[model samples]
Structures are given as C-alpha cells and as structure tokens.
Target: MGKIVGSAIVSHHPGLMQCEDFRRMMGAGQDSDLIAGYERLRHKIEAVKPDVVVIFDSHWFTTGYHLVDGGAHYEGVYTSDEMPWYLYGVPYNYRGHPAFALDIEAVSKEMGGYNRAIAHSGLERQYATLNLIKHLRFELSDTPVVSASSCQNCRPEHFLQSGAVIGEAIRRSDLNVVLLASGALSHRFVDIDWKPNHPRIFHESNLSSPENLASDKKAIALMQDGRHDRILEDWDSDFRKAHWEAFGAHYLQMLGAMGGAECRAKGEPLSAYENARGTGNIHVWFDA
Candidate 1:
C-alpha cells in the first residue's frame, strides 16, 4: 500500500499563490496571478515531491458535507493545439475527502480531547489536507490512476466511513512516502471588512489596517482551548470580512489524517501577501 511521503503548505493568498508555474507549464494558464501567491505555491508543491497530489479547495463546495471521488476517471483536458500531459494511458486525479463531514465531537474523538489533544498535537484550529498519491502506488497496479467523479456530504459518523474509504485507497497504493497536511493558524485581520462572492484577489491597503488584535487574540485563545465551535465562528466571521483566499476544510482534513497528534509550526507567518491577508502558511512537522 502507499504511504505518506511528505507535504508542503503555504498561505494561498492570491498575492502568494505559488503553483502557477507548474500550472502554466502544464497548460493550465486560464489561471491568473492576479495574486502573486500562486507562484509560491508551485515551489511548495515541488518541495513535497508528490507523484500525485490531492487538493481540497474550500472555495468549491455545497453547504452540506461533500467529498469528491478523486479516483474517478475523466478524459484528459486536451484540445486544439494542446497536448495531453499523458496522451497515452490514464491522467492523474485527486482522491482525498473534504472536511465538511468532520465536526467538533468527531475531531475530539480523533484527537482525544480539546485540551489534551491540542496541547499534544500542537494544532491550530485552522488547517488543511494534502495526501500524496504516491503513497497509494501499490494500489496503482490494480487500479491505475484513471479518473472518475462524485461528491458525498454526510454526518461526522458517516464521515469516518468516508475516511476509511480514503485510507483504504492509500493502503492499496503501496507508496513509500505520503505527503500529509499543511496550512495556516487563523484568518482574522485588522480593519478588513468583507462579504461572500467577493473577488479572491484584491488591493493591500483595503486589508492592512492594524485593528484586528481582539479577534486574533480571541482566535488564539479558542485554539489553545480546542473550542471547535468558537474557532469555527471566529474564522467564518473574519473570513467573511476580508474574503481573501482560504481552504479551511482542506486544512482540517489534512490534520485529521495526522491522527490529531502534536504538531509544531516550522516557518515564519506570511500575512501580507494577498492584500494584507493573514493565512496560516506556517510550515509544520509531526511524529507518527
């Protein structure tokens, strides 16, 4: 079966978006660096060295719990003058589930408890998942990296079943190294008022006002306490305000796969990339 190899994460502020180069090289340029953040993301992905990568984007989801069947097959995205990255056999696809099915109780059970687990796991309430497809390389012999699709949204209990499904996929792959989760700490910013359906990228001055101390402190406290409800509330409130790039469900699922163990953030916080947006791009590592 495949095993997690390594993982890399950075704040996805449109300003700091880092994977554009890879995307462009692969002919996925419909994307815009309207935010410089994409460029940095590519470096992060490269560092992970994943044969196949699963990305959980919060921007695309229904209100209820939902998981995209990443292993499902699809025709390669080729047309006109474009050649398929893999013109012969099968194309790569994503397989991890999103975090909608995971709730506070389920999270607690997975981690032990709010206080004990948070202190032990060193997890910030904010996080995301990036399971490496290479981990499932063995399974590839039976089920090559063909593509398919479906979305499922269920309760926490049902979510566990979903996790089992994903885990099974990994175990079958027979991969050596599996890239795990990576994401930010929180998203409250000073003077950043916002709304939904707003642009993903924006100007810096509109976001960098220094009035977000209260919210930030509150978030830190909730995280320290392992209060998922409060953490969710504060995050959603602030998220609506600045409305910059974010991937909450993505980070949460990554942390879930880590067995809720103690994790220490490894890098400096990069908060000024996308219009002075604050993201938990802090690098982290943990023991299994």
Candidate 2:
C-alpha cells in the first residue's frame, strides 16, 4: 500500500528565485535561511525515498472545484506573469504521475468531494510547485510530481475534505508519496511605495504589521508543539483573520490528509520565520 512518508510547509516566495548575490543584497548581506532550508528539507525527503511528491499549490487557485495536474509529463520554459522580469525564461522539465492523480479524483468522487484531475499537458504551472522543485534539486528522472490547486471559494473545511480524499487515494495506490504545502503564513503584502523606506524587504520588521508577525509566530509555535488541533479550532476565529496565503488551504489540505485535527506530527524548523514583501514565510518539516 502507498503511504505518506513525510510532509512540509515551505516558502516559495519569488525572492528565492533571484541570484545568490542578489538574494544576499536583499537579505542585508546574508542568504535567506529558506535557501539553506531547501537543502535540509531535500535531505529529509531523500531519507524517506518517496516515489512521488504531491504539492498543494496555494497560487494555483480554482473557483468551483479543487484541481490536480494529471499530465503525463511537462517540459517548458516558464515566465511568471505576476513578476515576469524577476522569474523569466526559466526552464523546467518533469514527469507527472497521472495514475495517482486519477486515483485522487476517483476517491474524491467516492467521498462526495469536488476534486478533479486534469491530464492535459497544457495546464499552466505555478511558482508554488516549481519553486520547490528547483530549490530542492529533484532530478527529473528520479521522482515524479503532481500539483494540486486550492479552490478559491472553499473554506478551511473544504480543503480538509479534499485532503482526506487524497489520503484515501494514496492508500489505494502503490507509490510512496511526500506532501508539500507550498505557501506562506501571513500573506498581506506591503504597499508599493513602502519599499523606499523598507529597503531590506526580507527583514522581519518589514512584515505587513506587528499583528501578522505575531500571528505567524503563534502558528509556528503551535506546529512545533504538534498542536494542529488548536490551529484548526482557531482557524475561523483568529488565524483566518490573519490573512494566510490562499486562505491557508495548502496547509489545511495537507493536514487533512494526515488526519486533520487528529494529526500530531511535530514540526522541525528548517528555516527561520522571515518576511517576504511583508508576508511571513518559513520552512518546517513534519514526519508522517
């Protein structure tokens, strides 16, 4: 039977794509911890030897239903329309696990969830998934990947339901898998004009507000303590109000697959919580 060997909440902020020298300049002469964190996270993943990595892409938003890329393979040069100049002409080539994706769709149908697997190769790619692949240095021939989209209209529960379906699907398949929640904590961006005053954009002081910073730290603490139950309980009342990226669906879904509020996987910090354009970002690994 297939099983999830590990999982992580990782930062995929565009700043990580910049050249090392450029990243150092932005980090006040130090490299973003996320850079080194990727290496650490990759080593952990290697230890588990997963055959496929499933990414819950916070940036690939769908409206009516949850979506998963089931394409056979993907090969292309990508340029982020959101920030073309910064992430232009990037080459990417990777295999996709179509059978496993279809299995997820099948399980979703059985569970009365709204999830679909799109096998068309033309499906657009998002940085949330691509960035991790690049930073983790996954050899294209070794491990295939599948990208799942977050439904924009769904609440925290919906994401959890979708994740449950994915977990069932994984159990029915034969491929060992790793789950990645590719997004940030507090996602409120600073005003365009604010950069002039906050030149060191990556510094924690540049986070959108003190409240966002505190909220992110609180969530991090809960994760470290394996208190996902508390985080879920407060989703609507507090954490949601902090404006987590993609409504925090990436994390909700990943946790859902791991048994939702029942999961007690402790998080190991791979990167220090930091700021990216006023949003909170970090990398934390959870052994499943």
The predictions' CA RMSDs to the true structure, in order, are 12.2, 1.3
Q: Check candidate 2 and list the clashing pairs.
A: none
Candidate 2: tens digits of C-alpha lDDT, residues 110-225: 89999999987577889998898888876543589999999999888999999999999998888789999999999999888775235665778889989888889999999999
Instruction: Quickly count the clashes in candidate 2.
Output: 0
**Per-residue lDDT over 1-288 for candidate 1, one digit per residue giving the tens place of the 0 to 100 score:** 564444333343322223556434422343333223323434444455544544433333433333332323322321111122322232333332222112322533454432110111221111122112322332342222211111134333332333344433444554433333333334544434553222433332233343343344444444445453444445446633433233344444443343322333232222222332433233332222
Cand. 1 TM to true fold: 0.41
lDDT over C-alpha atoms for residue 101 of model 1? 19
The lDDT values for all models are 0.33, 0.91
Which candidate leads the pack in lDDT? Answer: 2
